[model samples]
Target chain A: MATDRPLTAKGLATRARIVAAAADLVFHRGAAQVALADVQAAADVSGSQLYHYFTDRDDLLRAVAVHRAAELVANQGPVDTLPALRAWVEANIALIAADNAAGGCRLGSLVPQLAETDPQTRATLSTAFHDWIAHLAAGLTTMTATGVLPPTADPHRLATLLVAALEGGILLAQAQRDITPMRTALEAALDHIASLATSP
Target chain B: MATDRPLTAKGLATRARIVAAAADLVFHRGAAQVALADVQAAADVSGSQLYHYFTDRDDLLRAVAVHRAAELVANQGPVDTLPALRAWVEANIALIAADNAAGGCRLGSLVPQLAETDPQTRATLSTAFHDWIAHLAAGLTTMTATGVLPPTADPHRLATLLVAALEGGILLAQAQRDITPMRTALEAALDHIASLATSP
Candidate 1:
């Protein structure tokens, strides 16, 4: 069991701030370029205070990865029908636009950077992906169960394709510095999915 | 126009060897983790010789990206019919498996790494992607012209989806260290494409 060190109300707020700032930097600046000092400055915490809250940089990175994974899952939300799928997709695009171009997917960025050198980091990345896949698959299963999709469907396959399409669409969107390709590609994918449903 | 340096036959061979070596390392080791010395040793070239071909590490990276772009195009080959498409995909999977998970992707790995910070590097990556998309699109157009696909079918859309699907499939395959997902995903996607022809 892990030891429990209760955080003060102020302490909890500061730590949250630190993690958010770290995520912004890691996503925009690339995890490797953002140092501990940078995270401290962004969080507006003193060096001693930052160290006190976290054991070290890796501990903080671990936290950031988990935070980003949850955010990624939360970003997708739920899906009911074609319109719901479209709305979910629109929200996702807005999430990217809100970050401008500085932040691509945080978990996506961190995985490639650490995949080669750090085993623990790789495991963190893998877990994040597994969580993400499960969230998507669950949403897909729900869509099928609710009769938004036909019973003769493979949620896992659809979930896999959806994730891949989004990631690939994001890649093109980032390259072109425009969301049209991303939007168009995703819309087409959703259309494909809609065709799978029995007409209401 | 860029200057074309005069080279002996042997010098040309040496340059190809170096680029191939770097390509292998970048593919298997991930680009950021590879060192100059490792490339030097693998290529069997002296330090001076390596520098002679590429002005710096970034230049060498540019070369590798170019080489990879060519390799990607070659791997996709000429897409004509169902058999051709299957062959092209299987060839790509075999190539990835040969590397034993060392190389995830060349341009895919470099895009996020270079785009945010370096404009010049970003330009190179953008060009590589543009070339790749054009190659796939051209092949798709031919397939449609041959009456294998519908006249109303948009080749560009299918091309875009093909690229997206491959990238996404590659990501999953890398994480799981299994080729099954890649194979299954591609087959399913191809099945969808065939469905387009039969749809009433």
Candidate 2:
């Protein structure tokens, strides 16, 4: 919870429910368009339950941002080697395909739909993306240490490209209702990274 | 116009004005939340003036997609050469910097913001992207033809990555209020393409 108040396990579950419902509503529809009443109905929570978890709309959105950030970051697996990165990419593609490419990037779908977001919420979302980028960067750094890639390869830059391929590819997938764009984008970025491999 | 009826020059100007305003509105605020009335006010046109140009909202969005597509395509300078593509990237970067990184990609900005778009309208937007993708692919193909790149270079795939970088990079730029993500993404893709060039 964004609130510092201690929560029981049941209380934590309820808060998670509200945030999940709020995230879904905000993703399909713009944040400015989804009302508290809609979130309450979707979560099957009383107004008291909603109010107990969040103080206001900004607070709720911030919580959603935080929750989503953690989820997105946690979703990434190993990326310290070319094979591992390929596996990671394929796993993500499978997830999207399983959803029939309906769900865009879990966090990215919410970014553009937000209107008049507070600076704090915006920062939270930005930090979430950066945190994900840092994780990928860390893997690339490990690859360098393991002699999988040349030290000349900039992990930060490569990671940035990989993440963009993901965010942008998902957008393309949503538009075309096909996974080719996403797959191609990810492969291109991965190829670029693999191109930096130290000849074994 | 998506409508078959041809318009006079002044009519075309009015229609273009309406689209630019509507695109701006849709880019910042989601399409579902933006009303026809709001577009009318933003464009400073009477309701008749608005309806005279568009039969309804879907027609208007289709027009906006068309208008934005043409504009984005025209914005790309010659990309048949590596240097030309680099220059193109820098020009785009300067444009974003000039705006203080406020505006996102010209076409991609409206994509996720639209909710429940009509099929025809969605197809129009998709084709618009494909057109840009084709343009970039054509450039890479030229490289293969001119022997700038080897025959093994896959133009379509490379081009997809390039456009993804642009769209995804811009999304990152919007989130971070910095141009480095977009720059890094474009460079990484460009480097991949450049790496395909045969040794001179």
Candidate 3:
């Protein structure tokens, strides 16, 4: 989303380039306001070239949603330790601050825009988040093994809470051009996680 | 905004009626998708009547933003005690459940749609949230007064955190068509708050 994820320059094929341009447009203008002409102009691709990449608007939108969701998971880093996770939140806070809290959480921003509008894209997004939750669940599970977190901690639930807090805080932060909400939410989540750590 | 507040039957004036109808449209369809013609039809007001109430589409969207923000604060109930504050969260969780998390949040849903695109409405929303934070801060301050919260709790900070958690959780919940995230986020915030309670 907006908070993290480094773009992979491994593939700059015509199709991938189009998706990247579309994703950027979606991030700035939102999905509904983004038009294919706009995407084509932004991508510097001809009509046929864009058509070769996608069937229609809905298709391009689904691509944008999937691209962002997958990128977020792919970019997620190690969190087997509480410090790493806190650093992740801090890094996200940095993102909001860097964007002046105006750019918002790129992936999280899509949820409100598309959740009700597109079922197919929504399903695509749902799977990505499911994988995201699983990825987080696995990391937190490892923490329990390393004795970083207490056995009583439910990795799955904590993972979900942390993600929610991150997205919600970003949303709030964006509303006011302030990072305090994002900072506060992340701190609260991290502190709660710290509280569950093996004392000392 | 979607999760709480009862629409008052108190004011059915033409202006208020138009704002209410416009608000509903904005909730279902993002503000970008809400057309002025739709608002007029929805409000059953003539074009002139609509113009009489709103100078333009942006004006009406701003009205919707302002209306929902005020409604949330106006409808907020007593949260002087820890239980009451949590009850508010529970009530919000119930809203996501009742709406199947599909309808999304009315106020929060606006953040992504307008924060960057429409500065005036964003400012309108910012003011409402400021008032909301103040209202919540006032309530949380009372909790410290009544010993419902420890003196260690920063009411303003905690209030921002709670709102952030709640919005973040709801956004996450809506993404998956699941209430688990919302429940998890809210419970985590309340649990943390409870942890700071004056020992028994």
Q: Which candidate number maximizes DockQ?
A: 3
Model 2 alpha-carbon miss at residue B199, Å: 3.8
Better TM-score candidate (1, 2): 2
**What lDDT score goes with residue A15 in model 3?**
73
lDDT of 2 by residue, A49-106 (tens): 8888898877788888787888877787888888998998999889777755564666
Once fitted onto the true fold, the runs of candidate 2 whose alpha carbons sit more than 4 angstroms away are A1-6, A28-33, B1-6, B28-33, B55-59
Using lDDT as the yardstick, the better of models 1 and 3 is 3
Looking at model 3, give its docking quality level: medium
Q: Candidate 1 residues B1-109, lDDT tens each?
A: 0126877799889888998998778766666667899999999889999888888887787777677767766655677676777787787677667754444556676
Instruction: Estimate candidate 3's alpha-carbon lDDT, on a 0 to 1 scale.
Output: 0.80
Q: Report lDDT per candidate.
A: 0.70, 0.80, 0.80
lDDT of 3 by residue, A3-106 (tens): 13354554237678889999999887777678999999998899887776577887888888888887887788887787788788887788779878885888
Q: What is the lDDT of residue A46 in candidate 1?
A: 93
lDDT of 3 at B144: 91
- Check candidate 3 and list the clashing pairs: A1-A107, A2-A106, A168-B168
Recovery fraction of native interface contacts for candidate 1: 0.30
| Full ranking by lDDT | 2, 3, 1
TM-score of only chain B in every candidate structure: 0.84, 0.87, 0.89
Query: What does the lDDT read for residue A125 in candidate 3?
Result: 70
